[model samples]
Target: MKHEDMVKSLSERVPLLKKEWLGIYRRMGEHPHAPKWNTLCGDRLFEADLESVRSFEGKLQKERLNFRELPPESIILWCSEMERRSQWFESVLNGIDIKNDWCRITPMTRRDMQSKLEQIVPLDADLSRLVVNPTSGTTGHPIPAPNHPAAVGCYDPLIQYALRMNGLNTDCSGDKVAAIQICSQQKTIVYHTVHSYLEGAGFAKINLEQNCWRTDESSAFYINDMHPVFLSGDPYSFLDYINRGIEYRPESILSTAISMEKIVRDKLHGYFRCPVVDMYSLNETGPIAYSCPHDPSKFHILPNDIFVEVLSGTGEPVPEGERGEIAVTGGRNPYLPLLRYLTGDTASMNYGECSCGEISPAIVNLGGRKLVLFYGKSGKIVNSIDISGIIRSFPVYTFSFIQRSDYRCTLKIAAGGELTSRSAKFMKEKIESLFDNEIKVEIESENILLKEKTMPFICELEL
Candidate 1:
């Protein structure tokens, strides 16, 4: 956008964008790419929201009872509102009382979200403020979620809380850039913007790919020049960032999109001399939990609004400390009010006091989502998320892509409709192109690609 239009856009979204920050804002425009600021609180409501998060953080630092079933305060009112305004909830709660017999109500699945979103969203939700976030992070199923600007902007405070828990009290204010979300994708958008929530500290999302910059060294130069206090990205991108040999030292790195293995986490910390936090997040639900600083195996739930639960195969709530599918209810996203939404991920819930002193329940033994890597013909590393993006376009309920040690790939897809040879061939060719046509690919139709859980990406190559 032109400088005049950019100014108007920024002014509308962030009414409080500081006059001093205009220099950094203008500087951001001079970068290689144009800037895009999708969501910020329309007014000064973000100020009150930030204060609320501060109060919640104070409570978070104290020991308290970890509620079982539903979070007591939010459940009743949320259910009544959903029943009154949500078509899906109204039908599901036809005769069942969610308050007294919450277990009787069927847990919402991703399939429900995929097929019946219009009915699920509350009728009273403000459509004017809605923004769609396209996601296929897990399960290889692309579902676009509706979000609001204020809710998306709320992530800043929650992120700050996670950083404080990790023993890094950061200052992402003034003229300094607060953070950069780096990506290593073959294709992605790169932009920078000043956040009103961070008091005009700049934030950028840049791709580490060679073509993104004028020269090979320009990527490193740009990052060092920005000098962001911290960084955020998936494990694959972080690895790519390190491999590219960027010399900028960040206070910490927040890893999300997929579960980070211990080896990768340890390697990141060792290289950067910073805490590498594994955050369990989804585009559908925003930020869910962050890895406990005291215990790597445990993830402390982040937002106070959501209620977390573990459900058995039959959808019954499992006994505390038992392994089951992770389901969540209630979130800050006004456009998407979730009720017992099954995350399609597994973890055992722990209600007892944690060693980290976070009374909010911790999800232990989290499983399902993982960081898997593939190799291109030119020895280029491929991330699972990219592969997921390609396959998500196909007519498949779910899929499993496996790369054997020989680099031969096999895609087993549970077809959403009747599988045709031509479509399968196209899917096979797409997978081959992802590997630069270096590897052979076989497309197979399966009645059920997933068993108890979905492991969409698997690699056997030793690299």
Candidate 2:
């Protein structure tokens, strides 16, 4: 079936399933297993989308049988091919009136692309067939990034490459994929989506809040029954699942969206007993780097499509192994050709070949958008990931926590309307418990728009 036809079929069926699940939940009343009904309903709904399920199954067979052996030399050749095929590169190389060196053009930033998205597109590009993907506004402002279907097709190879690097087989004949991500006003949106390469692999997206499930145990049981082969989610969602005592293990787990801290990584590894792959990706630039299972600290850059550089504040390249802003050049996204785009991330680079025998430059000491550190009772600093899980539990439009001191903090929330006192009290209690009641917590409703660049948790206390 065509993608459009399948989408239409699923679109018609989704409403019916939602209505059915609502009735089931209503009938179950306050029973312990009421929430499990949603999960089961989602699974069945996805199964009904026969086209996507079959497509994904075919993709899995291909991935398992065919693995591309990408070495350093092949990566260099691939980068060269990308430049030749890129219209943006050609335009830059041929300056306004005369041929100019590629280096003469300044690197582009996310802000630059946001302002001149059309100018960056190749002169010969066909925009009608391209997909417009908007960044999730986690950093500061959301930007619409464009990509051709062919460019989007490159994800499978990179994913397979990462899997191969970790010594995990790409072929999982009949296993499904469970992806936990944020959904707008939906407890869970389950559907079967097939990748170009991994056709027929089951895919489901679940939201991780009390609103999504009746209890943690029900969610855990539903996951175990589905028997997903691969599980992927943001750090906050995964942490919530871990805390919920979920023991169903998949072959591999992918952590994306935010930087994965050592504590979180350790806990995930300890509980899952599987390779926890940390994927360094952005909406603008897909699959930048992936953590090596052998050494999670060392991330092998996806040299085929992305060329990475670490630069100082002044735009000069930083010394090897020194932390600097991450700059990227060359990508498959023709609509948003990134020419030395400064990705608001800090990481050092190691030129030395990795122990895994891949010679691609590795990003070390990866850090994300800076967030103010909160001090705990014993003066221990609290990372942003430590509190994100707590904040995410609330059904608010946007929220932020400002830490004034080790003993006091304020929670500002924008729920689009007046936040009920009961909900506010519940959030306050959760925060207080997390801080062991040593810190005084205050909840205030505010009209604030959370920017992608703004850290949700900010500490004004001077250490």
Best by TM-score: 1
The segments of candidate 2 whose C-alpha lies over 4 angstroms from its true place after superposition are 1-103, 173-190, 214-216, 369-463
| lDDT of every predicted structure (CA atoms) | 0.77, 0.59
TM-score of 2: 0.64
Q: Would you estimate the TM-scores of all the predictions?
A: 0.88, 0.64
Give the alpha carbon lDDT tens digit for every residue of 1-463 in model 2: 4645534544443422332233222223233433422432222223333344344334433422211111234334543453565654555545432112323445677655655666677666777757654343344334557765555555555665676567667573322442323222223343333332343344455554456676646667656655666677766667667766777888787877777788888988888888888888887888888897779988877635456778777766677789988887766665776766888788987775678866667888988644345677767555454455455555555557788855588877666444578877987887776666778789877666554244566788876
**Could you tally the backbone clashes for each prediction?**
0, 14
Candidate 2 whole-model C-alpha lDDT, 0 to 1? 0.59
